[model samples]
Target chain A: MTFVIMFLEFFKTGLFAIGGGLATLPFLYDMAAKYPWFNEAILSDMIAISESTPGPIGINMATYAGYHVGSQYFGIPGGIFGAILTTTALVLPSLIVILIIAKFLERFKTNQFVKDAFYGLRPAVTALIAYAGYQVVAESLFRFSTFFETMQIGDLFVWNAIILFIVLMVLSRVFKKIHPAAWIGIAAVVGILLKF
Target chain B: MRLLWDLFFTFFRIGGLTFGGGYAMLPMLQNELVEKRKWTTEEELLDYYAVGQCTPGIIAVNTATFVGQKIKGFWGAVFATAGVVFPSLVIISIIAGFIQNFSHLEWVQHAFAGIRVAVAVLVVNAVLKLWKSGIKDILGIIIFIVTFVVSAVFSLSPVFVVIAAILVGILAGQVKRRTKK
Candidate 1:
């Protein structure tokens, strides 16, 4: 059951997350809401981990989500199996669609309906990515549960982390084209140095 | 046999190097596929990016599939797809092992905190870049705002929001055509 559900959810995500991996963020948040297998925090962790690691972001996330969820129900083997199943299901749509398009992209490339659909979709995807970014920052910089429970500013925010965020933002503006991996490495080192 | 290996090796290296996401693979694709291997031209690469964007899966995988099929048909597509995702699967599996063991440690916890903040910044920059590429004019802006608010709202399902955006886009496109006439 875990395997089937994992396969199906990711298959749907693969189908509908049209723009790219970041575009998949909304669907993932919904999945966290819908399933008890994982929660919002883990989802953020997945995004961070997925962003840092190699391979495709969407595929890495689906694999991580599937493994974590499946392990709870079955075992480690079940988790690994679920990961394999999910990765396959997630890419199946692209394989089919790309094959079809490779054959006839010439005709469809200039299609009006396609153009309009994409035009509208591009902005929407941008918005979705923005929403995703907001979620990531919120998770990174604040302790929401603590804030809600205590209703105090000190409880609500982690000033040290917030400082790191602002400093990173400044560095980003200065070195606009440095590889993201380098930035991630520097942050990890600083986090260790500061003892977080 | 060698052709499949070539496809796999090329994409495997590509899959390993790209950090940000599918879009980050663009220059690497240009260098390897066109300048290095002659698998695709610059124009064809752009076409793949555009088509890949609107397609139903990860853009990088879709682009790989397109390039693979063009080179060696269905099997070529398989090899390329496998290659691109192969490194991620391997590396992430190892990370999963370490994370399970060390996630609760003091230093690991702190490092992740820093990494998360850095990732947040990266995502913000990505949004800004997307803005320059995709959002222009009033209609695009309207679509962006509506989609952002609706999807960001906890109560609203993102599925409906995406569907609404597509429908409105099609309508707006049709109206713009009529106005031009």
Candidate 2:
């Protein structure tokens, strides 16, 4: 049952979450809302781990989610099977869609309708990504629910988290050559020192 | 056999080195696939990206599928997709099996605390780059703002947003063409 649900949910995600990897966030968050086995914090970990490691972010995340969710129901073998199912299901849509497009690439690649659609789609993808970044912000440094619930100033923000955010933002703009993984390493060190 | 192996290894190497998302693999793909092997050209690669963006699934996988189909037909697509995915399956299984459960430890928790913040910044940087390239005219700005607001506040389904955007784009193009005459 867990395996079947995982396959279907990820298949939906694969079919709908267009505009690339980061765009998968809202769908993943939706799954968390519906399931007890997943949580926002772990989703954040998925983003971090999936980003740093090899391969596509969406595939890595789907596999991670599948393994975790399946493990709860059937342990190790379920974990492995879940990973395979989720991955295959997630990429299946792309396999079909791309093959169709590639079949017509010579004739339709530069079609006017296609160009117009992309003209609109590209900007929307930009906004979608911005929304994804906004989500990362809300999930990471700001807990608006807690801030409202406690009605406390201290709960308003994670100061250290924001500081790290700002510093990295500034450094990225200035340095322009610092490797992305190095930034993660720095954040991990800062987190340990501040006891975040 | 050799074709499959080459497709697998080529994409496997790309899968291994790329750090962020599908887009991050662009430069490396250009270097390896275009410059080194001449499997595809710069123009074709960009087209693949555009098509991949409009298609379902990760752009990386979609791009791979298109390239594989172009080069080696059905099996090429299979080998390429499998190659790219092969790395993540192994690495993530290891993490999910062990480290992910213990990720609740205080130090690990704190590490993610800061890691998320940094990652947020990286995602923002990616958006900025996309904005520079994607958004241009008035219609583009309107679409961007509306989608961002809807997504941030209401958390609307992204599928709905993308579908509507496609319609708007088609209509806007029609209007522009008529006005030009």
Candidate 3:
């Protein structure tokens, strides 16, 4: 029963989460609020892992979330099952839609309606991704969860995080050709070595 | 049989090599599918991306599916999609298992803290690239700003925002056509 619901939820995400991988962040945020499977903190981990790993971020996340949810209910085997279930659910909608579109590929590509809709969608999708980027920054760098209780402005910022973010941003620009996984590996080493 | 296996392996390589996000897979795809394998042309690949953008699904998965369909029909799409996601299943599952077991440790938490910052930088970079490519005109600027405010501040559902954008785009296109006439 839980598995069925999991499949359905991710299936909905796959069906409606248009644009790209980051575009699915909003829906995942909603899921975090509604379900006990994962939380905002885990979502950040998902982003980190998904970004640094192979394959598309969206599919990786779906598999990760599925494993988390499934493991909670069952054991390790259940987690693997959940991963397959959710991954399949996420990909099913895309396969069906793309297959249909492929059948009439030329017509769909040249359609004025499709073109016009995408014109507006492109900017909106950009905004959606930008907003998602802000969420990651705020969640990781701000002490929002404790702000109301303490109410101290100085205590609001995670300075270590801020410093690291600035450093990484500069390094990324300077080392433009470096793979993201390498940066992540470096950050992990720095974190452990410096006790960040 | 050989062609199907080839599709699977090619996409598997693509799925395994790229990092960061879906868009990051583009260069890898061009190298393997277009330049190396000669499976798709540059323009056709762009069209796949465009269609993949508007359609419902992850862009990378959709592109793989389209490329697969173009090559060997239904089974090709199936193998390609499966191959693309295979690495994520294996890699993430192993990491998730370890992370769950050791997540309570101080050092692990510290590592995640630093990793989170890295994730933020990558996301910000992705946003900048999207802005460069997607935002073109005054109307686009307006839509971008409005969508950001509502979704971020008000926490509106993204589904509603996407639907509204499609309607507005079509309406604006119609109005432009009439004015030109």
Candidate 4:
């Protein structure tokens, strides 16, 4: 039953989370609301870990959720199975779509309607990404202040994160030739050392 | 065996190092897979990205799966996905356990506070970049604003918003087609 559920949930995520992994958030939120196995807090952690880690955020979250839920429900085998099932289900949609698209690449390249459609899709994708970013910021920065009356408006700003952002932005520009891995490494060390 | 290891290690490194999620991983992915390894050419990677964007799931994972399957087979896909997920699974689990204990600790809270601001900036940067890349024309800009306002203000389900936008876009395209004719 758990396996079935894991497969189905991930399948749905794969089927509709177009525009990429961050777009998976809204669906994952809905899943949390429907299922007792996960919650928003866990989703928050998933975002953090997913962003910091690699592959895809959606796949990573699915794996995390599967393992967490599966371990709770059954045991190690359940966890492993859940992880496998979730990853498989998540990738399945893209695999199928890619195969189909691959067959039609030449045709698609110059099709005005298809081009226009993609042109439309581009902004929608950007909006989706923005929304995902907003959600993360809201949870991490603003949610804390709402809990207490004494919390200042300034408390919600997260200066360290802002500083890191400025630093990264500047670094990205200054070191255009540098690899992203170097930036990530620097951020990770900074995160640990500054403990932010 | 070496093939599988390469598939796994590549994705594992990708998963382990990147921050700011899927889109942020794009340049890195292009660099590693397309430029560095030359496993997939630039054109192939772009096509993979396009398809990956249109399909469900994370673009990074989808790309990994596609490349993995292309390079090897079923086992390649398996190892690649595993590699991509392994880092997050370990990291999140450890954080979860620690959070259980120090969730309320002041310094920890302060740290997250700082991280939150950084996250917002990262998100803004992502949005700006996407806006430049995607919004090619006035119509695209209008569509973006309308979608953002509708979705953000009303808290509409993104699925419905996407559907509505598609329908509207198709209608607009038809109108333009008739005008051109």
| Model number with the top DockQ | 2
Candidate 2 has an interface RMSD (Å) of 4.6
Number of backbone collisions per candidate: 0, 0, 0, 5
**On residues B95-181, what C-alpha lDDT tens digit does candidate 4 reach at each position?**
533444343555544444444444455556546655666677888788888877776789665556666656666677888989999
Q: What is the docking quality class of candidate 4?
A: acceptable
**Per-prediction fnat:** 0.71, 0.78, 0.78, 0.47
Q: Report each candidate's C-alpha RMSD, comma-separated, in the order given.
A: 6.6, 6.0, 6.1, 5.6
Clashing pairs in 4: A53-B15, A54-B15, A55-B15, A161-B114, A161-B118
| Poorly placed runs, candidate 4 (over 4 Å) | A1-82, A101-107, A134-156, A191-196, B1-9, B19-56, B63-83, B89-126, B164-181
Ranking by DockQ: 2, 3, 1, 4
lDDT for position B60 in model 2? 79
Specify the highest-lDDT model's number: 3
lDDT-best of 1 and 2: 2
- The order of the candidates by lDDT, greatest first, is 3, 2, 1, 4
Interface RMSD of 1: 5.2
Give a tens-digit lDDT track for model 3, residues B40-121.
Answer: 8754665576567678998889989999999999999999998888888888888887755344567776776676677677
lDDT of each residue in A24-61, candidate 3, tens digit only: 88888998899887899988877766755667777877
State in Å the error of residue A65, model 3: 11
Q: For residues B2-99, what per-residue lDDT tens digits would candidate 2 score against the true structure?
A: 98889988888777656567655665576568767899875466557656656788877887787788889999999998888878888898889987
Q: Lowest-lDDT window of 10 residues in candidate 2 chain A? A: A175-184
| Model 1 steric clash pairs | none
Q: Among all windows of ten consecutive residues in candidate 4 chain A, which has the lowest summed lDDT?
A: A47-56
